[model samples]
Target: MSNTPSQSQLHNLAQDIKQWGAELGFDSIGICGVDLRAHEPLLQSWLDAGFHGQMEYMARHGLMRARPGELLPGTLRVISARINYMPEDARCATTLEDPTLGYISRYALGRDYHKVVRKKLKLLAERLQQALPELKLNYRPFVDSAPILERPLAEQAGLGWIGKHTLLLNQQQGSLFFIGELLIDLPLPMDAPANPECGKCTACIKACPTGAIVAPYQLDARRCISYLTIEHAGPIPPELRSAIGNRIYGCDDCQLICPWNRYAPVTQESDFSPRQQLLQPELLELFSWSESEFLKVTEGSPIRRIGFERWQRNLAVALGNAPYQPRIIEALEQRQAVSSELVKEHVDWALEQQKLKKDQEQVENRQKARLIRWIKKALPFHA
Candidate 1:
């Protein structure tokens, strides 16, 4: 082992790291010592509750997730970094209110964050390695790939506190950010934890259409729109479909309703800006895309990971909630005639919804026309 760097040198290094992180597009950087044992029981209990749904990997990771040293054989501190993902021009309120528009999670509307964050982290690690040849750094960068409890580590590093929605929230940046970590075998100065600021605020919990929050700071991933649209592989549960609205990718209801989000900084990174037709796409318009078109449009996007089948599946559910129209009926039938069994099932369900809606609209239009005729008859001159 090499001699420990002096306190002043370590402090200077921390400052340099922060500067480098900002230069590399990261909004904030903090160091956290490796001691997450306290979080193990909570993780285990959450898994035991089966809140993770079909994501068996969460349970399989066991205590390794909470113990970073064991997962990476790291000897010292972790460097946690965050990048704000909320697009500068994103219309959060309008998208939330207009259920007909597909509400993609803001984080996913742009380029895939995993690749972008990892690339920046790798560059940061390289810079550190070059700065001290004798430092003997054993560093590994991770985005959302590993079992690491990123939010808690970010909190311990003083990036932000874990909010009631279980997302890391900064006083200045709110919760519209993505977190990445660099586990290194070097001692670094750490920051004080940010104080929790979610007092008396139940907006996120109350706003959740599926009650996925379950309790404050606790999330049942099974009912979460983000989980269902992105992480889930099979057919979504029937009950949560209506609550999902037209979010074909992921949901941002909690963040939209959070009072703290008013302070969330919009990202300046061009890579995080909305691409293709993601920002204001109509449900039927997206449903009209062929599989090839879907692949082409979603190229280099995080949405591609879900594959065309699941993408169609999500859209089918959204179509069911859309106002019934002839085009919607045609779209469902077109997919049903040649789609996979899984996609076919969802299309069939959407067709049933469309039929019901058509019947209702017919009755409403007939009543409306009758009222118009009655008014005309009452005013003989207008007739």
Candidate 2:
């Protein structure tokens, strides 16, 4: 085997990598050794619990996910990078509270992050190869596409600690960021793990509308709004529909409730800002989009991957939760006329809610009139 680089040289290379990462738009960068043995058992238990839902790929990768060297042979160190994604001008709390407007997760509001982050990681890898040609570099860049445990690797690299929500949270940056990794053959200096800062904080757990976070650090993807809207293909479950409120896409209630997010920095990247009227679009407006229009508007967006059917499915559930109105009723009828059996079922349910509201209003009006008559009779002088 060839001789290893000196300790000073390795340390210098590590410092150079951090600087290069910053220049390439990464908010932070750190190195981690490829030994995730301690994490393997927890991963297996999560899979065994069937918490991954329909995402069989999570279990398909098996132990390779925890073993970076096995996944990409000759990998000695994993370079983890984070990029803040909360756009400076993006809508947050106000958009979520509007029952008539659709609420999309902040990260997916702009261009698809997977493509952007992967491209940057690949460019960073190329720069490293050119800088150290004598070093036999074997690197593979990945974003969310692979089965890599990105959060654990990022935490191990001292990027941040895993918060109660199971998301990586930084002391200075909070949890509003995207993570990417570059597995390489170079043996670089590793950073020490950051101290956990989420002390006795149960805000994320209590805030989840779907109760997806069963406990601290444990998530049931089947009940997660993000998973239901983006991953699951069929009709959403009935019990969670009302709780879903007017969110036509992914949900962000947990993140919004986290106190640490007060310090979350807004992203300067314009590509991450909300696009195509997604920031505060009315539920009926999005529900009225034809399949062609959906494709056109979501061209480069991550939302396009769900296809029009699942998109309609999620919209149907949101419409069911919206306040009763004639326009909403009419929109549902129009959709029901040409909608699939699955969508028609949800439309039927929404119509029932409208009928109930109308009946309740009539009963309330009659009761108020009777109470006025009783008051007039009691006051003989006024009568």
Candidate 3:
């Protein structure tokens, strides 16, 4: 347990890590040095511009997010790993088009990815430790659980490039995968960074519902639906509510529209499979759940962190955007009376939306009736 490994030993270890990652359900693994100082300026600019919104942890960490060595001392090489989380039959477009159905982000439809990806990364790290028992190996695993800038690290490690949507995109796997990191002290051969493949394609930028992607590689999280519904705890902005559509939780519009996603592999992991209850459930049915029911159903899932109040708040906005269904109106009304100021505000807004739709439908029906009467007078009954 006292000898240092040769350069050849380090190279072999990197290859073994990738193989171990695959056996642990990770789709891809790459290694890179932790000199993210080049990204510090951009990170500071993003924080200064308030693009992170209420996610103050982003700023609180400062440039340390880009410095892995600071997070875990003696870090030499970062082993970045990605696992496909896109389930079979995600029905991304179908669910989005159906206003009656609630659109939870594809990633959140199953068990929480934090635990799943981190568990596998830990195994990969353990395998490395076991491989070199005498080398005094030091390591730590992170799956979107720490302040480290994961996407940039993944891109630098050659796992993928940062797409226009600011998510990691691989030529083979696209962007429907979870990224994790294993910071290690061993000096491993680093992988070449992936070249940008996005070309002139602005599909992701155009596809963002809230225009959260203000520019290529720049995201204004304040306007993002995923941020509004999940990260932000206050009232949903009235201006952006209608744009949120039926997305009760996080969103996937950008990923759904990406051309490269045609090659996205369906996850083999059963843990990522969509639950029947959350896989495009009726807005009314989801809206009907009480606090206890919400907790029970979303237990062990990523959606549980948002709690029932935000759940109702999001559903209220979605139900408002739904077609003028009397039941939807009744549901919003029922919630509005007993809800807190936060939930009640959204419910009231939803009721107003329903009322407007009902009025518009009435106006259209009257116009149709008038047109029918005019046709009857102009031309005698032909039947």
**Tens digit of per-residue lDDT, candidate 1, span 1-383:** 48668899999999999999999999999998989988989998998899999888888887789989976785588999999998888987787677677878889899999999999999999999888988678888999999889999999999989999999988888899999999998888888878898998999999898899999989999999989988898888888888888888888889888888889988978899998599888888888888899999988889999998989999998888887779889888888888998888888888998899999999999999999999899987887
Q: Name the best candidate (by TM-score).
A: 3
Lowest lDDT 10-mer window, candidate 3? 374-383
Return the top candidate by lDDT: 3
TM-score of 3: 0.98
Off by over 4 Å in 1: 376-383
Q: What is candidate 3's lDDT per residue for 1-383, written digit by digit as tens? A: 24768889888888888888888988999999999999999999999999999998998989999999998999998999988998889888889899999999999999999998889888887788888877677889998889999988988999999999999899998899998999988889999999999999999999898999999999999999999999999998899999999999998999989999999999998999999999979999998998999999999999999999999999999999999999988888888779999999999999999999999999999999998888888876741
lDDT of 2: 0.87
Please, what are the lDDT tens digits per residue for candidate 2 over residues 1-383?
Answer: 15567889889989989999999889999899988999999899999999999888988997678888877888899999999899877677778777888998989889999898998899999888877777667899999888788889999999999998888999999899999999998889999978899999999999999999999999999999999888887778888888888787898888888888899999866778889588888888999999999999998999999998888888777877777788988998888889888778888887787778777888999999998898889986775
Clash tally, candidates in order: 0, 0, 1
lDDT of each: 0.89, 0.87, 0.92
> By descending TM-score, how would the candidates be arranged?
3, 1, 2
Q: Candidate 1 local accuracy as lDDT?
A: 0.89
Q: Candidate 1: minimum summed lDDT over ten consecutive residues — where?
A: 92-101
